[model samples]
Target: MMASCVFSRWKIPYLASMYFRGVMRIPSKESFLCSRVMIPDIECSSSKTMWGFKQYHDGRPRGPLWRGKKLIGKEALFVVLGMKRFKDEEEKLQKFIKSHVLRLLKMDMIAVLTELERQEEVSLAVMMFKVMQKQDWYKPDVYLYKDLIISLARSKKMDEVMQLWESMRKENLFPDSQTYTEVIRGFLKYGSPADAMNIYEDMKNSPDPPEELPFRILLKGLLPFPLLRNKVKQDFEELFPDQNIYDPPEEIFGLR
Candidate 1:
């Protein structure tokens, strides 16, 4: 049981397609002040807000601080409870629990990131990235960087995009094919085919096995640039021998 504190009036601007940004620092202690309070058993299908982790939005002045802290607390408690149930080979299970806790921490961070995106809080999301980068558990991954880049690109923050991309490299985490696909998509949407092609060029050198999805997405994105489309089409065919790659309709190429 937890003690009840002031009913936090914190609210995150509810947004459709929200990408939250948060670096959840789960407490190391087993006990929490929020443990005494009963979290309303509101049912939700969102994996991010499971266990009645509803975002409060009473038009409060405070943005997300109150909600994020409480949610992290609940998640920490859940982790502790989950570990207790894994009773057997106590030593081994303890190791498993530690790893799982890190995963939960990651889930919380991603939840916040996505929520922030949904809210269109790009600045906050960028700040959250900085905070996450400093965390001991933070590991740069392609997917994580993908979403961040997309957000930055939409906001036309090219400098931030380049910095993040460079930081990702310095972390010894090269962009994967999917990351290339997304950055290319962002560039296309930003009306910069040249930048998009630059990513495609780098993607050609990625060591990760060639995937059909990135190629397919890039092909769609390249529809406006016939010359570029042809270039990618040739590479797609060469990389995917078992699959059939189709060109856009003749009408798309302005042919009768």
Candidate 2:
């Protein structure tokens, strides 16, 4: 039975190709020569399979090539919009870029979505966050949130940065040392040193803060205050007696 089936399958393509050639012969000579050449179904199938295999071997899926192309197009649109230098036009451009990013993410093109993010397009970033929040994709433990927080802080959007931090906390995502440091730095820059100190103290008291957390937090928090600087250093020594202190000479203090 198997041999008979294989023989029948092999004959089918040959019969179909012969039938197609026969039909072509009835056409006028000029028309026949000018008409599209019909390749055998077997050949067409073989070519398609070969192309698919090549794509697969090259680490690309055979389904869609539009994802990368779409990302490039979106990037170009962002650039064109950026050049306008008008607030209303820039806002519109940002909205368009964000919409495209959301569409790509919905289609599960995570790589392209991530690339759009890496471009540091602030409008896109804000829109992405809105989409993430809407879709519940923004997890506190995810490093992306930390990155977004830092970006927002750097952009001097302190309100948004604080809101993101609150959202992270509400999601029960404990901030890492790096996130804490970024927030501390942001607070310091914004004339909220007390807030920075609060974050520093919280980090120092964490159960498993990073090894450098105490020293880094103390030094950063106290560096601007002369009297508190030595006190903070001494406090660090008391807390971690084995740690070394990089104190400047007393002569540098003009005490010589």
Candidate 3:
């Protein structure tokens, strides 16, 4: 009778656990026991009843996945990140070219040359050019060629610059006033003022020559140390023989 009692006690609990496991769909013996033992301040029930109870108990809301401030959009994020990395105006200019965020070709070309004026990184800039070439959005024009030449010249890769120039000529992309201005500035920056003067002279003979500011870039490169004021006056006189040479408007000086 004692042995019979022990068998009854064990058999009842084992069958109850198995039934619980089946009803709960707990999938494994370990999980079934874990669910039963981990119940907090709760009563154990039949396996068939436990599923609904578990679902009811687990129906509370969890927190959001990302609960911080809202994120900026992709364009804004790129601009903000670029600005943070590069403090210098020139570096920012280069970043704009490298990033291809500009909406217009003229703006992009201007930015590229402006950055090259401060410092040149030909390989990186060329990589940007290659990227531009691949994109259908930015069609390469005379301005692009001119900017590439200027970038190469500033990097002192004169041979490559000349090669690019030749290629431009072969493509029938005639060099414009801006192109000559860039070449002249490049020569002057590299201590080849004679070459710069030759380019300036050639530009003067072109059908459409560059005006004041581009000439100013050439002059600045040529007379970087202490600036030859009289020489500037003489060159301005030669370039604009009829027009009066005076200080421009305050707005033009970027002071207003």
Candidate 4:
């Protein structure tokens, strides 16, 4: 009886050890599938994706991948130029500007304005200049006024140039000698010698040293009026005594 009891206890342990060994060596197919489901393969995992070696979680996408074409540089300038088609339609033009131009950054807007001036679209450029003035970032930029004024003068839009000049003066932005020369030439070309003389008077009052080119332009333009010509000539001689005034033949002035 003692031997049977000992054998029974020992047999129980031996059988239990064999069963566990067999279970470990040959796992059930169902358990193997369950283990696969519980611990997923990193390669085939759906919750995470590998961008290079870095793991990215499944979340909202970002960066240039989700964004549209960015309007910058030449593209922004092109959009400003496109507004020229709607120039006569005031409401439509404003709507287009509000939609397109108002969104551009400061430099982009300035570039567009400069390109418009270069293209000689005086009317559109003026409108853009006014738009920029109304912006929160706007400052009293003398060069801005100078460029627009030069464009207007080149286009023979002297009336608009005078308006801009007035606006510039109100802001205490004085123009340079080139601006004076262009305005004087524009006025003379358009048969507005009175206005040309007015600009010359303004130039004389300017704090900047007078440039001889403007005096020469005034002398040439003022030939029809000897009094004005002589006044300009006198100032020229005083400012630059070294330079000689070209006395064109009187036939050139139809005075003889």
The most accurate candidate by lDDT is: 4
lDDT of model 4 at position 193: 91
Q: Which stretches of model 4 miss by more than 4 angstroms?
A: 1-75
Off by over 4 Å in 3: 1-121, 124-140, 219-239, 242-256
RMSD over all Cα atoms, model 2: 12.0
TM-score of 2: 0.52
| Clashes per model (N, Cα, C within 3 A) | 20, 0, 1, 0
The TM-score-based order of candidates, best leading, equals 4, 2, 1, 3
Any runs in candidate 1 off by more than 4 Å, and if so which? 1-70, 73-115, 132-144, 153-159, 249-251
Please tell me which predicted candidate would have the highest TM-score against the true structure.
4
Q: What TM-score goes with each of the models? A: 0.51, 0.52, 0.37, 0.70
Worst 10 residues of 4 by lDDT: 40-49
Model 4, 108-143: lDDT tens digits are 888778777766788999988898898999999888
Error of 1 at 17 (Å): 49
Query: Model 2, clash count?
Result: 0
lDDT of 3 at 115: 43
**CA lDDT, every model vs. true structure:** 0.63, 0.58, 0.57, 0.81
Better of 1 and 4 by TM-score: 4
lDDT of 2: 0.58
